[model samples]
Target: MATAINVQSSCSEAEWKARQRLAACYRIFAYLGWDEMIFNHITLKVPGEDDAFLINPYGLHFSEVTASTLVKIDIDGNTLDGSTYPVNKAGFTQHSLFHRELPDVHAIIHTHTTATMAVSSVEGGLQPINFYAAAIVPRLAYHKFEGITVHDDEGPRFLASLGKKRMMLLENHGPVVMGRTLEQAFLNHWVLQRACEIQMQTLAMGKPVMIGQEVIDKHMANLSQASIDPVQQGVPEFDAMVRLVDREDTSWRE
Candidate 1:
C-alpha cells in the first residue's frame, strides 16, 4: 500500500476529493462486512472528466483502499494513471459500460453479498414484501447472467438490461446499484441488501406474509418523491459508518 501511496498524478482537487469519497466508500463497505475480499468493485466518475472514472486497484482489500491508491481509467478500459495495480476485467466491463452510456450516473457499487446473490439466484428476483423492497422495486432491473463478463459484446446487453434503472440484479451473479453520487449508491446498496436479507429470513419462517399491491404501490410512490440527495436521506447512517472506519484506521484518507 505504501508503494502506491501519493503517486504522481495530475488529478484536480475535485477529482482528488472524489477519490477520497470513493476510498471512504470502500472502507465503509468493509465496516459493514459487505466486502468480498478482492472481488467486487465500487466506482465513481471523475469530476470534470468526460471519459475518466476512478475504481479500486484490482488486488487490494476494501480496507486497504485509499484516496491516493485509486486507479483512474478511461472508457476504453485503459489505465490512465501510472499505477502498478491492474483494474478488474469485470469491473471495467460492468462499471465503465454504464458510466459511458448513462450521462447522469456518477457512481456505481457492485456486490456479491450473501443475501443479494441468494435473491439473484431465486425466481422473481427481489420481492416486494417489505418497505425496503417496495421502495426499490420500481427501479429494479434484471440482466441474465452471461458467464464472466470479459468480452466487449456484453456491454450493450448489460446497458440494455439496466435501461434507465438505478438498481439491477445480474442473474446468477449479483446486484449493481448506480447513483448520482457515491453517497447515493451506498444507500441504494444498503436498501437492496437489506431487502434481500429480509426476504430470505421471512422465507425461512415458513411462507412469508406478502404485502398487498395497493400498500406496496403507495410506498413506491412515496419513495419516488423523497429526497434524492444521499446526504439528506443517508447521512445519519453514512456518517456513523465513516466514524467507525476512522476509529479503526484512517489509512483510507491517504
Candidate 2:
C-alpha cells in the first residue's frame, strides 16, 4: 500500500531524541563506508509507544537522512500508509522483528557493506580478530541468509537468533545490529563493520592475528560499564553529527 501524506500528530518530544540519533547513525555509517545507499535501514522504537517505531523513508541515502525525515510504522510493518513518507519492504521486515521482539532494544541497524556482507557470505561470520570484536563477543548472533528479508518466516528466525542479543550477521545476506539508543546502535554498527573489515583484512594478509579471549572479555566488560551513560557521549555526538550533515543538507529535518 502507498503511504499517507501526514502524521496524525507531530512526533512526541521523546521521539525527537530517537530521530536525531537515527540521523546521526546515518552519518557514522557513511563514515565507516557501511551504508548500502538507500537500501539498508536504521530504525528506532519510538519511546512510550506500543509497537510503533521510526525508519528512514525509502529512496534516501544514509548521508541524506535528517531527524524529521524518518517514518513511523506499526509492528506488522505497515507504513501507517497515511504517513507523509514511504518505506521499503526490506527495511520493514528487518526492523519489524527487532521492534516486536526486542523489548530492551530501542534501535536497530541493518546494512549490506563490502566487508560485512563479505564476512557474512563465508562459511562462518565475523571472527574475533580485533579489539572491536570484544565489544560484541558472545553477544553476536548469526542468521542464515535466505534472500532479501521480504518474507514473514525470516522474521522469526532472525528474531529468534537475536533473542536478547545486540548484534546479528544475516549470513549471505548482511548484518543487523541493535542498541538501547540510536547512538548506541550506531556505535554498534560502526564497531561491527570495523570488526568485519579487520577480520577480512587479517585473512587477506595470511598472517596469524592471535587475539586472546581474555583480552576480548576485558574490552567487552569495559564497554558494558561505559554504556551506562551513552547519552553523555552518544547523544552529544549525535547532535554534532546532525549539525555536520546539516551543513551539507538540512532537507532531512524538514
Candidate 3:
C-alpha cells in the first residue's frame, strides 16, 4: 500500500466526507471481487458541488485506494486536486455524461463483471426472471457499444440512449448504474451482478422458469413505494458489509 497521506486539513468537510465514502466504496468493491484490476470506475459527486467529483486514480488497485489518494476532478476533465495519477479518459467521458445530464445522481458505478458482460453481449439484455432483476428491470435502459467511449462526441449518443434510466446495459460492454448515494450505488451493482449470475446459470441448464409480468408488476408496485435507503433498505445489509470492510482493513478510512 502507498503511504496514506493526511489530507484532512487540505480539503473542506464536504469534500473530505466525499473522499471517505468514495474510498470506502473502492475497498468494498475490491472486497466483493467486483473490481476490474485498475480499470472500471466508481465516481461520487462532491457533496455540495455541482461539477466536482471524486474518482479512482488510474493504475491503483481498488484495494490500494485510500481517501487521500482519490483524484478530484470536474466534468471538463480538469484535475481539481493535486494527484499525479491520470484519470481514465474513457471512464471520465462516460461518467461525466451522466453526471452532467442527471443532476440528482450523486454516485455512479460502471462495472465489467463476467456475468454482467455475458448478459450484455446477448439479446434481451437484462430480464425480469428473478426478484433482483425485477426490481431494477423497470428502470433499466440499453445503449449500443460503438467502440471505446473516449471521445467527447460519444457523450451525446450515450445520453440520448440512457434517457432517464439509472440502470443501463452497455451492449457488448457491461453495466452502469447511478445512485442517489454511495451505498445505493454499491447495492445496485451487487444486486445486478447476482441477477446476471442467476440468469447465466439457469440458461445453461435449460429454459428457465420465468416469473410472469403480472407478478413482476405487483412486486414492483410495492418496491416503488418501498423506501430504498442504502442504510435501511434491502434488510439493512450495506452497513453489515461496511462493518466487514472495516474489520478487514480500516486503511480505507484514511
Mark the regions of model 1 whose C-alpha exceeds 4 Å error after superposition: 5-9, 225-233
Q: List the residue pairs that clash in candidate 1.
A: none
Indicate the worst ten consecutive residues by lDDT in candidate 3. 228-237
Off by over 4 Å in 3: 1-5, 228-235
Tens-digit per-residue lDDT, 71-174, candidate 2: 87898877642556678987887778777777878888788888888988987577777777766657788887687778887777777787777788888888
Per-structure clash totals for the candidates? 0, 3, 0
TM-score of the candidate numbered 2?
A: 0.85
Candidate 2 backbone collisions, by pair: 3-81, 4-81, 4-82
Measured over all alpha carbons after superposition, the RMSD of each candidate to the real structure, in angstroms, is 1.8, 3.0, 2.0
State residue 39's C-alpha deviation in candidate 2, in Å. Answer: 0.6
Tens digits of per-residue lDDT for model 1, 1-254: 32584743576788888888889999999988999999899999988997999999988999999998899999888878777788889888878888988988988999989999999999998878887888878789999999987778988888888888989999899999988878778888999999999999988888777778898887777776876654465656677788888998998887
lDDT of 1: 0.86
lDDT of 2 at 239: 66
Q: Taking the tens digit of each residue's C-alpha lDDT, what string does model 3 give over 120-196?
A: 99999888778798887888899998998897888788888888788899999999888888777777888899999
lDDT of the structure predicted as candidate 2: 0.74
**CA error at residue 129 for candidate 1, angstroms:** 1.2
Best-performing candidate as measured by lDDT: 1
